[model samples]
Each structure stands twice: as structure tokens, then as C-alpha cells.
Target: MFFRALLLLLILLCSNCENQKGETSPILQGLLALDYLILSDPDRSSVYFSTTRSASVEIAYEDGAEPNTGNFAVAPTTSVWSVTESNLINAFADRGYTVNVTVPTDLSSMSEFPDQGRSTWTINQLLALVPKYKAEDSNFQSAKFFVVFVKGSLAENSGVIAVTVSGAFGIGAPTVFVFKEIINHFQDNLSPDKVRKAEQMTVTHELGHALGLVNTGIPLSSDHQDTAHGNHCTNTSCGMYWALGDDRVDSFSPGTNPLIFGSECITDIRDYTP
Candidate 1:
């Protein structure tokens, strides 16, 4: 009987030790904090964090269903942003994390953007840009999703992710406002044929920022090329590379679609996810 009692005690102690170890280990919790930044700029928004650690992500659109209120309507062809968001969600979902998208009406106001700095999307507009997920899935409700704006400048400086669209260059962020001189040059001097392609590539590039594949501005040596895309290395010929300009038609690789990140980029994301 004494031996059996001791055995029970040993089992309980082992279980308790495991629980304690789990409580103290940083791997799961550490991953969560990293994921918070990877998903979006939690610092800029007012989302709450939990004390307990878990492998789930939640996304809320700032103003998903509002009407467009800008000077001009968004072109029909520009609706690819929603497609891009869908692709992003699918890509993340394939990796075993849960993501959720919400549209909190109370958080839907234009004042979210500061007045003093460069004009950008109001919180309301940003919310509107976020795509709506119609398909019913419980997992999506628990995963990390992002908000987007349909009619505002593409410039977003949310904590670590900053996106700027160069409208004049016709290549980077499509919604960015450029100098009148640049706009005139593109309209008159540059080939009008390239505008559409440039706009698409620009959105993909900006999305790269959203995914945390940033340019470190360091020159690439031969040794670094395999790992870093020369200087722009991350994986999958990501749009984050600075060498891709608006003027060149071949700069946009259909095989390496801007929406899909390279393999190395995926590893970085997985590492960043909590």
C-alpha cells in the first residue's frame, strides 16, 4: 500500500512539474508577442492582449462596409486589394494558426489618422478597405486579419510596417498622392500603357511591408545572395525588393506574384508568429 501511494505521489509530482514547466516556458508566449507585430501594428490600434498564451490570431476590420467618400471613386480594376487580403489569409491558414476578422463600428472614425502628418487613410476609410469574408468558418473568426481602406492614401506607418504608394511613378502604392509635376510627367511623358501594371505591383510591394519583409538597405555580397535574394533576399522573389521599379514591364513577375511571398519569407513569418 505504501509503495502504491508513493507511486501516486510520483505521478502527481510529475504532472505538476510539467504544468509548471509549461507555465514558465517562453517559447509559446514569446511566439505570441512576435505574432502580434507580424499580424499588424498592435501599437497603433487598440486591440487587447490576453495574459494566457495560445496559438490563435484575431482580425477586426476598422470600417468594412462603409461607402466611399473620397473625391474620386476607386477604379473597378483596383479591387484586387480584397483578393490580396484573401490570399494572405489563405496563406496564413495553411500554416496551422487560427485567424479572425471583425468590424467594430465604434472604432470606425476618420480621426484615427493624425492631421499634422502626411494625409493618409482615416480609421473609417481603412476599415472600409478591409475585405469581408462571407464564407462561414469558425477558424477564421479566431485568426488574425487586417483592415484596409478603399479611398485613402496608401501611406501607412503602423509601428513596424510602413506602406507608401507612389502615384506619379505609377508603380508603388497606387493611392499615394504625388507632386503635381510628377503626375503631369506620367500623364504626358510616360507611356500610358504601363500605368495599370505599375499600380498592381505597387500594392503587392506595400503588402510586403504588412508581412514584415523590409529592406535593410545593406549591400549584398555573393555569400548572402542565396539566403537574401542578393540584397533583397527573403524568399519567393517578394515584392519587397527595391530594385523593382514602375517603369519596367518585366519587373513584375507573374510566376512570383506579388501576393504570394517567397519561401524564406514564409519562414520569417512562421518565426514571427506567436
Candidate 2:
């Protein structure tokens, strides 16, 4: 009986050690860098990071001039693309991973060129564009989230990140929508650098939602919690905070390296990622 007892204790200890190792595996912390492509300028944007290669990105632009259409503009210089890509990569890198970006030829012309006067496109119109590109490649099936630019009002109800989570796993991948009206509001009120940083913050914030982060107050009992499982940021400075303003880029600042979700959120993502 004593020998059997010793054997059982040894088995339990070995099991515990294996569990701890699984929790700390490097794969859990490894970076998955994203590549960008305008689709239209595929050649120029094809470059990628040496470590952990990236998948292609396709951006679609909405015609801003049509009646009721929104105003979205892309910078004339290639530097704009580079700067945006660099900003996103840096945001991820700050969290301990190296990121690389690539711009595709198809996305070159996918600038925000919305007309100043019209407001015809609705959220549904913008969402319809997602499947077009998502179906183009199989890699997108694994994307943590996707970002799209749209022309619309930045009024309190103007922008949002739509999330879809399954059962108890919490949030699945998220799709980020940037409104032209909000971007313009920042441009007029803040410095260029601030505007750019704000844009990056918004996109990153939406991606956080896609990755299982949730607001502090949202009831876990709700079905939404089953999928949207990240922590809520009470710190207004943190990106996870839900209340953000259109006029100030700093309104979105929790710093680039936003905090991870509570234990629940982490568990959900761990189950989903692998």
C-alpha cells in the first residue's frame, strides 16, 4: 500500500509539471505578424519580415463622390502606407514580438476618397465588402481581425467594431471599421502625428475586441461574454476603455501596449488560437 501511494504521488507531480510547462510554452507568446497590400500596388508592397512570414492584405476603397457617400482619403505619398504599417508593427512589437508588413498592389488604389457632401453608404454597405476579400485567400480564415476604412459620421454612434464569438470560447476574430468623419475630425483638431497614432489606436483597439477582450461592465452572463472575454479597462487612458472621443487622439491612448484581459479572456484565446 505504501509503494502504491508513492507511485500515485509521483504521477500527480509529473502531471502538474507538464501542465505548468504547457502554460508557459513559447508558442503561446510567439508573434503572428500581418502583411498589408493595396492589391493595386502588389509589387511595391510585397516585402515581408524575415521571421514569421505574413499573409497578404487587400483593402477596398469606397467612392466618396456618389450621393450620400462618405469622405475617405488616402495619403498621396507611399510614406503614408509605410508609416501606418510601421505603427501597427511597433504596437505589437512592444508586447515582445517582431512584426513585419507588406502592402499589396490591389490595395494601392483602395484609398479613402469619399465625397464631402453625401452620406448614402450605411454600415451594411461597408460590411458587404468584407466577404469579397476574405474569400480571396484561405489565410484570412486564421486572421485575428481585419481592418477596413469607411466614410460616415463620427457622431457618438458613428463607429464601432463588430464581434462574433462562439459558445464559451469568447470572441473570435474581429473586423475593424474606421469612419472617415472621425478621421477628418482628428486631422482638423490634432497634429498629423496624433491623427495617425489615433488611427492606429482605433484599429488596434478593435482588434483587441476580436481577440476576446471585453468591457468591465458587460455582464458575463450574456451570450456576448461567451465570445467577448477580455478585461474591461477602467483607466480611461487604456485602449480597452469603451468611451472615446473623435476630436482627440489621446482619447484613445492606453499606450500602444494595451493590457491583456483577465484570466477568463486568456483562457478563451488559448483555446481558440491553437
Candidate 3:
């Protein structure tokens, strides 16, 4: 296996030696993509949910979804990354894993989703892009997770805030998608801070799914899984609650912590051995 990987690396370097710097050859891209297929596992959550080694979460935003301080002028405290990264670190720290989440500034050098020129996306479309983008990550093998923020909605008006796909999806890389279009629709008549927190809540919630919350992959410590909703906690206060909330968006209130796992969910994570 070691020699095989070394040969592939040599091929990548030699194949691109005369091409433009930072651009991978078609053959190299195909080789890197094979890594994704080989990494596919039946147990999607265990690799991320209970890994003893430190893990990395890489984030990318589409052209429209790029993070900007300008959004703060329209809605105070609208920093998407600050809130999201903080909540992720806090949650994973509780589970005894050191998680590092990053939003790369240099996305032009990486593989990107093709310009489909649509306002909404389907899982199939995004799944096809996984191996391509996943191949670009330098830390692809170290318990890594991929997240992409796009300015669109899920297909057929699914009305979901976000979605998570595990190895079961056959993509190998576990991925989380946050739809800025759906999140923006909820900002009407509400403070940006509230909307900001709600968006953060959604990101963490889907990531919870990636971590195998409620009995998806990590077994339950108690009977709190809302089986009706498929891997959500029954507790209303929990971020993992199914359907999240209505269009008005009132799940988060002042002085209430919306970025959290319910106690039951935490118990399951902490008790997980693998």
C-alpha cells in the first residue's frame, strides 16, 4: 500500500510538472479520486464520532455565499464562521476530540463545484462533486469532514435548513451543506443576531448528524432518538430536533443557548467507545 501510494504521488508530480502550477492533471485528479472510493466505510460515524486522533473540518463557500463583514451592517453580529467554529470546537471538546475547523481563503486553487447555474441543488449533484473536492484536501485521511456553504435551496422545496451525508451515501467523505437561501428567507422581521445564531445552530445540527447523534451510527445511551425523524433527538430544546422550526424562527431566544446538544445526546456521545 505504501509503495502504491508513493507511485501515485510520483505520477501526480511528474504529470503536472510542465502544466500550470497548482493545477492537477486529469489523470492525477482521477488517481486522487480513487482514494475517496477506497476510504468508504460501512460505519460512517465512528471515524469522526470517536477518533482518538485530532480531526480537521474544511469549509468552503460558493461565490455567493462568501463570508463578508458587510453582512454585519445589514444584520449586526452576522459573522457565520465565528459562531459556527466556536460551537463546533465546544461540542467536540466535550466529546474528547480536538477538532479544527477552517474556512480556506484560497479556494481558487482547489477543486470546486461546477457552475450548474441553478438556485437549488440535489444530493446527487453535490455527491458527484465530493470526490473532486475531497481530493483537494491535504488532510484528507485524518478524520476529516467537509462542509460547503452555498446560496441555494435543496431540491423540490425540501424546506430543510441543511443536510448531512455520511459514507453510507457512497461519497466516502462525510459532508454537510448549509443553504444560505433558506436561512435568508427566515431573516424577515427578525434581528440578524437571531438569524445568525439560528444559522450557526443549523450548521452544528447537521454536523451532529455527521457525528452519528441519536442512534444513526453512535448507539443511544437512552431512548431519546426521534426515530420518526431519523436520527434527531426527541427533545425540543436540542439543536438536533427534527424540522428545526417554522418560517418565523423562534427556537432561539435571548439568554437561551441554541448551540447545544441535548443532555441525552451528549450522554450518547460521551459514552461511545468507538
Best model number under lDDT:
3
lDDT of 3 by residue, 36-56 (tens): 554545235555555434455
After superposition, candidate 3 runs with Cα above 4 Å error: 1-43, 67-82, 94-115, 135-141, 169-171, 246-258
lDDT of each: 0.34, 0.40, 0.62
- The C-alpha stretches of model 2 lying farther than 4 A from their native spots are 1-57, 64-121, 133-145, 154-156, 159-173, 186-188, 215-232, 245-274
Maximum-TM-score candidate: 3
Local accuracy of candidate 1 as per-residue lDDT tens digits, 29-64: 544444443344231111111111111212222222
Which window of 10 residues has the lowest lDDT sum in candidate 2? 31-40
Question: What is the Å distance of residue 247 in model 3 from its true position?
Answer: 11
Better of 1 and 2 by TM-score: 2
Question: What are the runs in model 1 whose C-alpha is more than 4 Å off?
Answer: 1-79, 100-193, 215-236, 246-260
TM-score of each: 0.36, 0.45, 0.68
Instruction: Give the Å shift of residue 156 in candidate 3.
Output: 3.7
Ten-residue region with minimum lDDT total, candidate 3: 67-76
